[model samples]
Target: MRRIAVPWGVLALWVAVLALAGPFAGKLGDVQHNRAVDYLPASADSTQVAKIQDRLPGGETTELVLVYHREGGLSSADRAAAAEQVADIDRKLSLVRTPEGVPSRSGDTVMYPVASTGPGQDEKARDAFVNDVRDLAHDTGAGLSVDVGGPGALATDASEVYQSLDGPLLYTTVAVVALLLILIYRSPFLWLVPLAVAGVADFLSMGVAYGLNQAFGTTISGQSQGVMTILVFGAGTDYALLIVARYREELRRFERPYDAMRAALRGCGPAVLASSATVAAGLLCLLAADLNSSRGMGPLGAVGVLCALVAMLTLLPAVLVLLGRRVFWPLVPAFGSRPKERRSLFTAMGSSAGRRPLTVLGVGAVLLGALALGAFALPGSLKQEDSFTDRPDSVVAMRTLAAAYPEASSQPITVIAPTGKATEAVATARDTDGVTDVTRGRSGSGWTEINVVAKAAPQTAAETATIEALRDGLDGRGAYVGGPSAEQLDLKDTNARDRLVVVPIVLAAVLLILVVLLRSLVAPLLLLAAVVAVWGAALGIGGLVFGPLFGFEGTDPGLGLLSFVFLVALGVDYGIFLMHRMREEVLGGAPTGAAALTALRTTGAVIASAGLVLAATFAVLTSMPLVQLVELGFVIAVGVLLDTFLVRTYLVTSASYALGRKVWWPGPLSRRLPGAPAAPPAEEPALTRTP
Candidate 1:
């Protein structure tokens, strides 16, 4: 165990250097790509490509569209008043330019477009502008209604929500964890220990995440940032609690603190390592996702769990070694005291389960299978618009636009044709299947801009096929389709490629970790298989629940990635806890059935408790504004509960008992160590009770 420190130190140093170097190295690839795409020309064949390309707005600009209405046609007075207020607000805002185009007024309504010219523009300026306009609208209360929408307004709202919620979420999580620890341990210092370990682990994990982003050019999204904080705090504290709980139990038997720590580590180390590996593997499965945002979360989460493991095994032990018995303080006398002889509920449950393993296992399997019936109902559509908060101004604006001009919600597809071929291209696009409208711009710079409107939403497969057909209609004669629809097609293609490359790599990594921890070829395979089944069940159930029950049209792309990673990682945690305890019982010379029963009796309650806490914490994500978060939270919470209770407690126990001692066969680790005394016979009471 001491030898593990050398590699750990080196990894920590590497992560530190990476974290420091990452931000400056253009590590935020997505941000950079966004800038580049904004600056680049639409394609050589665009009719006004040259003029518009050079005049394109900078990437930082925030487009603001204000919609206002009055009872009578916007009287000259109303229009003039609104225009003056907008101009005044624009003048006061840094980096803001009057929208290049003029305000357009129609009967009883007016529209104003505003743009920010630079990245350093203060968001407060937008807030102030909205506030002023809102006040003006209120002054004309009877006749006027005002609503602001655009990238700027949406950005402001999102930023405010995040800023407001982040601190409260952190404090709430910490408070909850602290209270839970204090209640469980009944020792102030001991309760604080997990928090201390978690804090260190979080620092190190974030540093490593920053480093990975630098080295790999990964982009961490807002969602990942939120999840990372929660995972680090929650999982880190959970791991520490597991270790400390065992340490306290050991202290009741050992005379010296050092002995207690060492014994606790030896007994608990394998379990901790296994649990971490499973979690890391599960999260790493996200690497298989098509979305880079989803893929990035995998390694980011894995790094966090790994850091927590290192801190628990090293930093935590070092602290305990220094603190000695004083770590328990006023609780010292309780350490050596005996527990009551009453039968615990957990033990009774285990006894019932053991007596009718088939019935318990059968019922669990049936329930999961029933939920999984919804799998076929899952929709694969990934529309970005559905991801927003239900009441967001952007969504409201979109709905309004959709109502005003039903087809306005549809995106125009850009079909670029070689110079001098504008007329022919427009004709060809209009003739193509599924094409509803084809408008050709006046020839400019010898090139053409052909806009093709689709009958269906551009992101749908029908529209994608239409685009492909139009591109094919143009042949190889230098026509490129590039628009929102085309970009979505490209995104889909990229995601498909990513999914193929990532899933296998993540699975391999998970398998390797399992094999290394279990040191048994058979057990790793079975555990991985069980995890896969649980993952399938989770996704299937999530699909059904979200699709039919909740009326979500399609699964959030991020949800699938999140589900895959969480199911694998969290499922592994339960597997490790159960399997490790089973191994311990076997080592105590208990027969297969008794060993399985004892393992369940001892570890089942803790695993169930941990799973419930994690599930509840994750379930809180449903309260977030975004639909994606809600779906993700629900899926992960359900998956964790499934893994902890059904898979870990029943499925795993059944498999292990069925395997018996053969589960440990073909491994030197399973055999009695040479020159070491044999373990006591199975008939002897294994544990030495403190009482």
Candidate 2:
């Protein structure tokens, strides 16, 4: 009765917590900050510009361009409609500066720069303003197309794409997991257990993430929040697979379901704990990042992982135990029945690997190296306007403006000069190379806003040089240069800097954790090196295909850092699973080669299933509209599959065989057997599998 009470009590506690968490969890999406400033480096020049601009006279002004065009030429009606829309907008919103039409050389497109201070510094208000403008700018027909576009509109569009991700991403992820779970379990009833638990864990994580946001003022970006969801399902499902696999094995050993569950948790719980800890710790390292989105992702992702871990280890087990062996349905493991004896695929893989370990290693190394060359062919940094895979009205309008205003800058360069040096700063900026024009604008506190236009297009190398020159020219004048172009420049430069700072920290942290868990320098380093290779190979594949195949002209700036964090963290997870089992066998007195093969044979199916589930969950992101998410999803999914099959099966297993006990080096497992063996009778391994 007490045992029954405890299980029911655990479920009740979870239900109570979920009830409390539901509202806060729902609010998480509301708190997501997807503004350009939200994603920028905290101390970047553009970030400073954005912050300063928000405090100026009109608040962060919404800069937009109202584009109206016809395929052949602007008809009389088209021209009148364009004028009428601009007039309506003028009456509808507060203008920072009155708009005037600029026509293209071909006379096919006409654009009007509409700057306004109506939205103030509120992101929601700003988004609403963009939405309202877009609605008003909608075409009235007769071969005329109108798009309300600019930085604010772009931000709004991007946010909408991100917001759209919530429903599709969750539904797709759940469906994918459910389908995979059914196939893996081969039991209609069994699949729902882990899937349901993962869903609950996701809910709990959202609430905790919201709390963390309130307490720490963490920057909750849509991407960060999205990653938390992936972790809940991906990492959560991985833990579930390991637990359930071990539970099934224990069920065959122990007579009672409760006893089986206890034994199973005792067997695999440490590995699960250690793996989750490594992942959490790896994710937590992102707090050191300078980018708000990247930095915020760390804690939020760790929270998701931790939530999933707790739910899977406790709640999932309780549910499974209460359901008993019949939950497995037709495939249920009865206490007295032994699984069919057959030569497993992993056993054959091990035999091939053991025969030519070095050859396999050499081949794998060459393959990884070849794949890494694709990085050089990757496209340039993704421009803000080209960030979306499917071009929205904002992108289309921006593109039109770019073509129409080819000789002049489509975006302004914002400079904040101290009030004392405002005159000299304005004069210096006007004289700077590539400065097409300069205008002195809003002033408050100790600073004045100076808007400048460059001859080069935004995010181009020429503009980058122009920006660099302006900074150099204004060095001692108390001026900071920023705008859309400047923000992009800062983002690109800061991403490079962060890679240098964060990569070493992540690598070092992961290494230390692996060493502590495995208790062997060689094994941990081996695992780390293998996963790193897999990451490089995966990214190379992304480089090779992202542009030519997927038609993405540019890669996301944060792709490298984010992908590294996930791959290394997740890749090492499978490594730990494989290596932990090998060590377990070795410690129990099996020879190194025998232990490696035995571990592979026993754990291979579980690892394969877990890897597939993780890979599929991540692949769901590819269906999202955002290029970055798609690229990220594709790379990680490919990497996991690679790590699971090629790396773990052939490479790690072969290396262990060739290296012998030294794979566990300096540890007691590394020592050779003390006595020469004489076969008295044929005996099977104590831990043979069912099927």
Candidate 3:
């Protein structure tokens, strides 16, 4: 009765958890934003400009360009229609100034720059304004078309993609993981238990993330939230796999399900805890990053992993115990039953690696190094207009304007200056090289706004030079230079800086955790080296695929850093599982060579299954609309597969076999065991029972 009470009590507590977390889980979407300012650091010039704009008379401006274009040239009727549409927009919306259509040199396109502050910083209102203007800017079927593009329109399109990601991303991830689980367990009922627990963990993570936002003002973005969901399912299912595999083994030895569960926890719980700690610690290192998105992602990711850990350890065990051995269905392990054993694939791999360890290690290193060289083939940093996989109205308008007005920018460079120095600032900006025109407008809270136009197109090197020149010309004059282009510049630069700072921290954090867990210096370094090589190889593969195959024009700025953190942290998990099991065998009086092979034979299937589940979950991101998400997902998914099938299976195992007991250098396991063989056996004996 007492034993039964514990499981029921756990269920009751989880029910209570769901009740508390359900409300906040849905609220997470409310707090998520993908705004430019959200991605920027507080100290960035663009961020400061945005803050000041929010304090201006009407609020931050929603700028747009209504592009009217024709394949040949605009006729009198086309011009008239464009003019009437512009007038209609001006009448319906509160514009900062009366927009005048500027004709392209080609005579095929006319763009009217629209600016309004009425929507302020409200995303919904701003989106409504953009949509309403789009409704007003009608396309005439006879080769005359209209589009609304600008910073405002681009932001709305991005928001829509992000908002759309929540449902599809979650559903797709769940479906992928569910399918993988079903295939792995091959049981009608077994797959549902972990999937349901993962679902609960995801909800719990969302609530905790929302709480973090409310309490600490953590910035939440669609990207970070989506990653959080992936981690919950991927990592949670991994933990479940390890626990269930162990429990199944224990069930054959122990009569009671509760006793079997206790034994299972005793066997694999430390490795699970250590791996989770490693992931959380590595992700927490992102707090040192200068980018708010990266920093906030640190806590959100750590929260996700930790929540998954708790649910897998507590709730999953409780539910499994309640369901008993029946959960295994046709494959149920009966008490005192010795199961038949067949030669496994990992057994063959271990034997081959053991026979020619050096050859295996050398060849694997060469292959990974060769793959790493492909990094040079990767595309340049992604541009804002090229961010989406499917071009939106904003992207179309920007492209049309770029082709039509090749010599000038349709986007404005926004500057905020002290009201006292507004005139001087304007003169400085106008005199700066690359400046085509300057207009002064808006004054409030002691700040004056100036809009500058450059001779070059948006996000190009020439326009970047102009923005730099404006900053250089206006520096220390109590003015801040910013705009969409400036914000992109800041994002690129900040991500580069963040990589420098966060990468080292992540490395040190994960290495330290490994050293502590393994109680050895050499093993930790070996594992870190293997995972880092995996990262480089994974990125190199990305370079090969992203441009040549996927035709992605640009790489996301944050990809390298984010992918490194995830790959290293998550990749080390398989190493920990393998090494931990090997250490257990070594402690149980097995020779070093025999232990390595046995560990591979025991843990390889579980690790491979976990890797597939994780890789598949991340692969779901490839279907997302944004190129950034797709790139990130592709690289990570590829990395996990490489780690699982190659690095863990071949390189690390080979290295361990070659190193012998010395793999545990300085630890007690490093010492020669009593009566152990002087060297590892040339071939290992086949086991009689399932490991």
TM-score of 2: 0.96
Lowest summed-lDDT stretch of 10 residues in model 2?
Answer: 678-687
Instruction: Name the candidate that leads on lDDT.
Output: 3
Better of 2 and 3 by lDDT: 3
Q: lDDT of each structure?
A: 0.62, 0.86, 0.90
* Candidate 1 lDDT by residue in tens digits, 202-289: 6666666666766786556556655776677767766676677667677778876667777888777767776787787767766555
lDDT of 3 by residue, 1-691 (tens): 8668888899999999989998998899889879988889989999999999999999999999999999889998998899887887898886877567899989999999988998999888888988988887888667899999999999999998898899999999999998998898889999999999999999999999999999999999999999999999999999999888888888889999999888888777878888999999999998999999999999999999999999999999999999998989978889999767778889899989999999999999999999999898999988899999988999999999999999999999999999999999999998999999999989999999999999999989999999999999888898998999999999999999999999999889888888888889889999999999999999999999998899898999899999999999999987888888777777767877788889898778888899999999999999999999999999999999999999988889899999998999988779877686444322221111223
Best by TM-score: 3
Deviation in Å, model 2, residue 215 alpha carbon: 0.7
Would you give me the overall lDDT of model 2?
0.86
Question: Which residue pairs clash in candidate 1?
Answer: 73-108, 74-108, 282-568, 282-569, 288-502, 288-503
Clashes of each: 6, 0, 0
Q: Is candidate 1 or candidate 3 better by lDDT?
A: 3
lDDT of 2 by residue, 93-188 (tens): 756775578788878888888887878767778889898888778886878889888788898899888888898999999999999988888888
